[model samples]
Target chain A: MKDERTVPARTATQVKIADAAIRVIAQRGFDVVSVRSVAQQSGLSAGTVQYHYRTRQDLLLAALERSVARQAERIRTVGRVESYRESMALTLRELLPLDGVRYEDAAVWVSYGAAAATRDWLAGPYWSGMRLFHDGVRETLERARADGRLREGLTPETAAPLVTALVNGLTLDHLNAPARVRVEVEAALDRGLRLILRD
Target chain B: MKDERTVPARTATQVKIADAAIRVIAQRGFDVVSVRSVAQQSGLSAGTVQYHYRTRQDLLLAALERSVARQAERIRTVGRVESYRESMALTLRELLPLDGVRYEDAAVWVSYGAAAATRDWLAGPYWSGMRLFHDGVRETLERARADGRLREGLTPETAAPLVTALVNGLTLDHLNAPARVRVEVEAALDRGLRLILRD
Candidate 1:
């Protein structure tokens, strides 16, 4: 009976732990991060972290959910732009690891995504988020096509995956080799957009 | 001294440990994997793994080097292919998680790559390997351009990054969503080739 009353409180604590876990994981990575680290980061006890997430894997799963949710929120918040180019450019720019926190988040997400590939249980939400992001990009391409802003012979269904891939790949490059040749990434994006956009 | 004769043997043993580490890390992730797991995979004692690599991080780094070396070998082999389309197709195809072993390797590399993003010590070889791959693609594009097979305006430098990004992103999408949409990633490649190829 008392467990019922504690449910809401427990859920709140779980959320806190998840959020803290994300930050800690993002900074130190899943490999080096410990339950104590997450607890310390969140200003909670190790017992509380254990109470919410029985194992390190469980904590990672919760952290992944929180991370994906934040990314989805960011995607949703991208307001309507005047042009297709503007919309894509804005959305993609936001997705890039242009800053410290975003870079850490991207890094952590990539790690989790890799783990998800082998483990079916971990793969579900990460894969779904990827699909949703792909779909959203496709919808944007479709809107551009309907507006006659895109070139002829291009379909959103076909182009969406390609565009998403380009953005993602470029993001990885940007993170991997920013000092040496990141400007090329921007140029590549421009060229890709030129290929699809109406002359 | 007797230590001089043991140097070669020690180096050989370290190589074996490194090779085994890749297999273990690929099966389990960098986080879940331990020195003992690597030692077990290598058929060596845990003491041997520790003797070669002082910590789990060191073993992970060694495994990363082995992964890079294998990928570099794959790239070098592909360089022998004559046709541009054939070479590009081969390279992109290899990047896909088409098989269990390759999938595991990709998963492990991606996880390590993500971790490397935050830690400077882990960044070197990973970034170098990426750059090497990028350079190889750029050289391929350059050859195509010299043969007058590519479009007039597009240079290798301009097209290489975009093509690289597109292929990488497509591979990621395929990995994440194998069931829902049969995204013909090759379509993106075809379109990209067409955009850059002369009529």
Candidate 2:
């Protein structure tokens, strides 16, 4: 039987289509993402795009896989720090909309969150990415606790998921009101972390 | 000069169309919400729907206005209380996706939040509604402090907005993974609030 977990090898054309799909989703909301739109954005023929992705979901899945890989690589680079406080800040901020690229990525994730609210098939991947992020926060919190860097009377299990939600909420506010939230984003993160992390 | 703040009178046809638009958005996602879609959802002729609401934005704005008024009324009813903790819980819980109607409202707000990321016109309303909600949280926090019910070392100004983001984050998480988040939603809110509010 074919391995459902294994991603098929992607050709250069497929890569181009996937990039185009992400750009399309980032530029116009995910609602306008289609094979034709991706093809137009990629400067290729509709049939060429179709041969690679076959459907809109196929295109989005490929784009999401790439985005997830890049994000995971980023978080991995920040792992194994001496100070869980610094590591915690970096890892969580990596998920925030701090730059143009991250902003677009956040936009796609937020739109998909809404789109997946009704599409059950999309929820699996959404939950997977979120669970992965949440686990990272939990690990950071646990490490901080072990190192005595976390405040007393707080458990990682209880606080980690809450931190995940706080970042998610802050990201939402930042994407929607960048100017208003930009000045306070870093400060807000520090304030939140201070509640559990030692000064 | 025309009064921009005063909403024009809504006929029965307009009210029906607005309700149809909300349902359409709640079920099909906002991408499919157009005059024709709302018309079909409302069982009204396209021309009839068009006559009352000239554009998709008009229909959406009407629906949002109705939704906002209803949400505000619900929040207003929960305004004053003997305990700020209980009041905070109730007020914030009103915004959570705890039921079908609230699930639909959060879906629409989250979708608009993503949609407004690039659209300047939509951003105004998005920020306005969010700012209104944030203001209420700030006021509640101040009241909690005056009553000596808030935890020490916390300012309403600093903590209120973070609480706003926390709830926003929790709402997003709940909508995406209802089963996983439903069990922990209330407890999560209490934990975050406890960081600021006294026991």
Candidate 3:
């Protein structure tokens, strides 16, 4: 799960181009994310963007790759919270679109995920991200159990997918109804965790 | 929820065109859904298709309207069940892609949902379908409460959004990982319901 083309940006130019792809996808949606538009967004020549990305698919992959890595890295570096609820609140909130950066990442994920329904090559990276995220949630739940923060009869193996699904669902709702859901996202996250942990 | 441009197909030709749009969106994704392609899929001329639905947006709306109306009508006509679990099981399962027609609706909803992230006009029907679906689940939960099937302290207001989120999440996951998640969608739905109802 961790090793599926999870490479970070290899150069400053590549990172810029990838960011440009994300901006294009976030602002105009993925259908308009061409090399020229990305290059224009990044204030670089189409030749330069093409040289780095090689194709439109490559550009999208880089954007997805960078977004996943950033979230994973953020979660990896977080300090532990006191209780299971705060722990979940921190970890799951990372998965939601609380800020602009995460919002764009989610936009890329949701938009591309919708398109990936009929596009196989586009789904590979998303699956990797999904697995990596599921593993991360499972690990967090395991820690809660070890730290005596878990409820009896609840296991990490069972709870991990539910947490991820709730997070996924919340994110989807947020994307479709940002104005209403944006405020409710954290509250919704906490509410779902309450049902999961019964805390 | 039911009145947001929720018009069903007004003619046989339009219904044919709407079904073709569904086939195109289901088979090839919404990005490639056009009047010409839908016309070809329906074995009709572009001019005839245009005469019915004028533009690609109009054609897509017709497809969405038909899909949403079909699901809504099906759920509205369901017979009563024994328990909340059975009631939710039946209603929520109706939202899933268990068969061909529902699969196409799920495909259209998922793909266009992703695209609607950036397309304002595209999201209108989705919001309506979402509201209608939410109201349906809320009503089911209300029935469960009246029948004395709901667990203590769980209200319809609190559980409705969560239930809808679980259904939404399962649909999103199935869209991305059909081979693995298809078999699990029902089981997952049941598990989520158990968490909510303790039944």
Candidate 2, residues B74-166: lDDT per residue as tens digits?
Answer: 888876566678778877887777777677787877887788876776778788888888888899888888889767667888887689888
| Fraction of native A-B contacts kept, per candidate | 0.57, 0.62, 0.50
Q: Write the per-residue lDDT of candidate 2 for residues A24-90, one digit (tens) a residue.
A: 8878768788989989999999998877777788888777665665577777886555666666777
Name the candidate, 1 or 3, with the larger lDDT value.
3
lDDT of 1 by residue, A22-78 (tens): 778667777655688889999999987887777777777777777666666776787
Error of 1 at B111 (Å): 1.9
TM-score of each: 0.82, 0.90, 0.91
Report the number of backbone clashes for model 2: 0
**Deviation of model 1 at A66, angstroms:** 2.2
Off by over 4 Å in 3: A1-8, A147-154, B1-8, B77-79
Q: Candidate 2 local accuracy as lDDT?
A: 0.77
Between candidates 1 and 3, which one is better according to DockQ?
3
Clashing pairs in 1: B151-B196
Give candidate 1's fnat, 2 decimals: 0.57
* Model 3 lDDT tens row, B71-187: 777777766576678667777787776668777887777776777778899777778877788787788788778867666667887777778778777777677774765677787
Predictions: Cα RMSD each: 4.1, 3.0, 3.9
- Compared with the real two-chain complex, what DockQ does model 3 have? 0.62
Better of 2 and 3 by DockQ: 2
**Which 10 consecutive residues of model 2 chain A have the lowest summed lDDT?**
A2-11
